[model samples]
Target: MPHKVIFVLIDGLAWQVAHDCMGHLQGLCEAGRASLYRLNSALPSLSRPLYECLLTGVPPVDSGVVHNQITRLSTQTSLFHLARAARLTTAAASYHWISELYNRSPYLAVRDRFTDDPALPIQHGIFYHADSYPDDHLLLDGEYLRQRHDPDLLLIHSMNVDDAGHHAGYDSPQYRNAARRMDIFLSDHLPGWLDAGYQVIVTSDHGMNDDRSHGGILPEERQVPLFTLGSAFSHAPEVAVRQVELCGLAADLLGLSHDKPRNQELIRR
Candidate 1:
């Protein structure tokens, strides 16, 4: 059965913090409405690289998007490409990096802020350049895109958690509050999304550290939380999931073709 997918990527949310602070998501798991799993992020644990890794299932070394400074369109086929190839509509309310990766390169704010070209991989987009952009606003941006285009695949990427983690240490109150805030926002939207028959996958690109940095192998930086709310998933929380498997999982949920490996244990027969 094919279903619409809404992927919420909360940037810089550590496993511990997300498990502890995101009570709404935890409650969903407890109530048997969602499944939770711990995922080991891709190598180096950097944002840009992991973003590419999660979307393409290709490591940074192979994708040539090893560092954040690499400002060019991705060479590898991504989830967006797969969705578009399948003739599915796609939209993203995300950071500029996403636009640069799948749509265009060297993002020009005025021209690229809002895009609606059906010819592109991401057929619709509302991209943001500031890290401090509010999570609530970003979610609404995604909602707007959804209401307008009704895309089969919609991406909502929030940045406040990552910004808070950078401004304060990952252990700081601000960082925790950011995750909590996002959870509250999700609570407001998840119910509607579920009722509307949209399968949702919420996860992060990478985690942050107590030193206000990442790009390391520390548990705080390498481990992240994955929560799946959909009928296609098993309501079992103990699945061994990995960051790169997300692309295939989404593709599977949407009935799209993907060459990447997925965690079959996580899906219900």
Candidate 2:
């Protein structure tokens, strides 16, 4: 099947929250429409570390993205880097740090930061707006770029849920409302993607506590949901897998041929 994957990273979404806020997710699991598993995030359970882990298939000890404290991570063997190396198109709707990570690649990176830099190499597609963008904004912006640019691998990172979690507590109605908003985006988009030979992978980087803070080894912070749904794995049954294994699964989805030395090391870790 000719299939591509659009992986959506919902920040600070817990598995427990999925059943509560994202009822669509629970419906998918119960109806066997998707394989939903509780996967563990990398320790520290911070955003940057989990993102690096998802992209590089590396651990905090090696990547040095131990926390938000660490600034830049010269990650050369990540998904974007590998996609560029193999001549595949890439697109993302994310913040400045993520755009900076794609500086070397000819990517359709839409920087959704507060500051707008008109001189950025990739200008036409860049989105420099306020920090008040809702959770569904990521999906809407990503859908725009994918329809316009048709990137082979697309990433849309939603930030509002995490923000709500931090400000209004993880279990607060505000956080649930944000997840519900994203649910509408998924409902409207995912089924069409499935029919059109596209994989829709939705998961979170970490989970927040009731108190609305993260950055520890607590189970609430360390475990999140992982779903692989599309024509690529339509007949695949549900199974338990490591969080890092997702990196390999993504490469396989993209038909990426060469695994860099660092990726090879991922197999052993």
Candidate 3:
């Protein structure tokens, strides 16, 4: 059987950071026989737009999610919709409300909502405190969901690294420390899932620049890392992929046909 898929998005993680902290992610790459490539985020390079692109397999222009605040509910369908349509159990855990904003949960389930309340708006769905890092929370929730419901697809988004990068700069000690923490979390907690039968795909929405800001169109702001581990990937490609393709990689990984016109140019056979 094809292993279940776990998509982990480490927010604001740059290629340089991934390389610098290779020791943390190296084992996953080697064990799962994965490849590494640079993927470009959407224009403007914000979190919401890039994530919406990831979910809907559409560009920011097509998805109608250009900024972090504009909630485009009726624009396009998300990966969750496709997964649900296929009758696959799906779960999502994130540190930011943007994930919930783009991928809304049903009325009965828990929801993470954006708020100025500082308490981290929880409309019902498993909402972690905004003041705290939700990486471990998301991982534990994923494990719980897997054990109790055996969800076929799980999505996790960690934001501490991004927060640290934004506040302390990309190359600061805080940023590296946060990355290291994420490394430890993955190494210690996620290997069991891989052993049990799961294909883990770790990537980022976008990379941080030298000044730690990324709402612009630049190489650093665009290029992100892609690491696939488990039974779903081929031999690791030795060459670096320079093309600015984001949704194409995702579509390929999920075994979905690329329908978006812009992604047609980015798709690699």
Of the candidates shown, which would achieve the greatest TM-score relative to the real structure? 1
Cα lDDT of model 2 by residue, 156-265, tens digit: 78787788888988768988888888787788888766776777778888988877899887787778887767645643444565667676667777878645322222
Q: Which digits, one per residue and each the tens of the lDDT, describe model 3 over residues 1-269?
A: 33467788888887778767757677656654565666667687888788877766677787677887775453666665655565556665665454455444322223343221212122112434363566666677656656765666667778887888888876688877877788888877666877877767788888777687888877777877877666556644554542234434444555654453233222234
RMSD (Å) of each candidate, 1 decimal = 0.8, 5.0, 5.6
Would you give me the overall lDDT of model 3? 0.64
Q: What is the lDDT for 4 in model 2?
A: 76
Our model 2 lands, by Cα RMSD against the true structure, at 5.0
Stretches off by above 4 angstroms in model 3 are: 30-32, 96-99, 102-125, 129-131, 238-269
Better of 2 and 3 by lDDT: 2
Model 1 agreement with the true structure over 1-269: per-residue lDDT tens digits: 88899999999999999999999999998889997788888887888898899888888888888889999999989999999999999999999999999999999999899999989999999999999999999999999999999999999999999999999988899999999999999999999899989999999988999889999899999899999998878766567887888998898888987798687787778
Candidate 3 accuracy as TM-score:
0.80
Span of ten consecutive residues with least summed lDDT in model 3: 115-124
Highest lDDT, which number?
1
- Each prediction's TM-score versus the true structure: 0.98, 0.83, 0.80
Which pairs clash in the backbone of model 2?
none
